[model samples]
Target: MIRGRHQEPAGERESGLADEAEGFLLAHAHRDQARREAEELCAGMPWLTTAQAEELTGHYVRRRLDVTRDLLLTTALRAGQLRQEYEARYAGLRRALLKRHAAGVCAVLVCVGGASALACLLAR
Candidate 1:
């Protein structure tokens, strides 16, 4: 029960984990896109129009800055941290999905082998 409401029973745990993992991957990708888009919007703004940049920052950013370089460095670090977290979460979910699927497949193969052996003994 790593999460609630979406958690699956042992029988189908792999598929459920896969689904959840895939969802987060897609969401993370979208988050990455949004981040890039935001940066592009800032870069594309006219430097002559400091008002537009200020206006954009007013709405889209909230970092306090006594100096431009410090603010830029801090914000960049924050973004990097966010990216790392997104990638880490995605990897974690992917691993969970794979582990669950492997367990499930093993269980199924065991059941199938047991049934086949029983059938052969019955026929002989």
Candidate 2:
């Protein structure tokens, strides 16, 4: 049983290798599928030559990249706008809180002073 247990690691290593091979095969398959789809698309347009098909694919890929770049830029701009709004709100809230705290302190001081004056008069 001890020997069998030691052999388990070897089995696991082989399984790991199999998994890696499967992943490689899957990636290749996906590339082939995309190529096939592109070929079909080119075939549908009988006027396009093989070179033109390749060029079209390149153009599409570039367009996709450009769109993605634009999307990222838009997202960043929106984020910045949101951050500024939040900061403005935070500053306003902070100022309000400070004013409230100051008012509370003044009320406390007045109460203490009034109580002391009453006490002094009563003692006399």
Candidate 3:
């Protein structure tokens, strides 16, 4: 996360807080899982000294965290790219739809005005 001080509106601040909380929870869960896996691996190798097992578990957790971080970063980058692409497509489609609607409205108005003029001429 980029660290900078900027005042946000209440709604946005709340959203940011929620996002932070969610991230914290997810990080904790990942750490817990990694530790559990490390402990299990250490458990299986009963011949290792206490210091060695601790070192191995620490290394394993660090590696797991690094891999997870990299994967999350990649996913976030792809998601951002996808969001931009979809937004651009949506904007283009919206413009086209608006143009078609305006044309249809103009056509309807012209038809109505012509019929009104014809009726007025017939009445005279």
Candidate 4:
């Protein structure tokens, strides 16, 4: 059963142990919270066993994770949509600015032409 156990690197073993410890702590916290919730719900009713409470807690945690994931996905999609809308608006504004600049240049040219014509008539 332990034929290749000695072949594992020391760092790998240490990391595995650390991961296990962390998982145990996290699970304990979840279980404790579950126990509290179950106790409240089970008040004035039949008591639940430790195993039952743990099972119920696991279900609660799974549902919570699913909801959190869905919320994150929705938020990310909305953010992408907002970014696209703003970018489109920025492009539209840039086009409008260029058109205004062109109109201003044309107006300047027309004024210069009128002034030059008046000077020529006066000289004649």
The per-model lDDT (C-alpha) reads: 0.73, 0.81, 0.97, 0.78
lDDT by residue for model 2 (1-124), tens? 5765655577898999999999688656655656666667787898998799998766655555566568768999999999999999999999999999999999999999999999999999
Error (Å) of candidate 4 at residue 43 is 9.1
Q: After superposition, how far is residue 31 of candidate 3 from its true place, in Å?
A: 0.8
- The candidate maximizing lDDT is 3
Candidate 1 is scored at a TM of 0.44
The TM-score that candidate 3 achieves is: 0.87
Stretches off by above 4 angstroms in model 1 are 1-66
lDDT of 4 by residue, 22-45 (tens): 978876676567656655655534
TM-score of each: 0.44, 0.61, 0.87, 0.60
Q: After superposition, how far is residue 62 of candidate 2 from its true place, in Å?
A: 1.0
Per-residue alpha-carbon lDDT of model 3 for 12-113, expressed as tens digits?
A: 999999999999999999999999999999999999999999999999999999999999999999999999999999999999999999999999999999
Worst 10 residues of 2 by lDDT: 60-69
Query: Deviation in angstroms for 13 in model 1?
Result: 44
Q: lDDT, candidate 4, residue 13?
A: 83
Worst 10 residues of 4 by lDDT: 37-46
TM-score of 2: 0.61
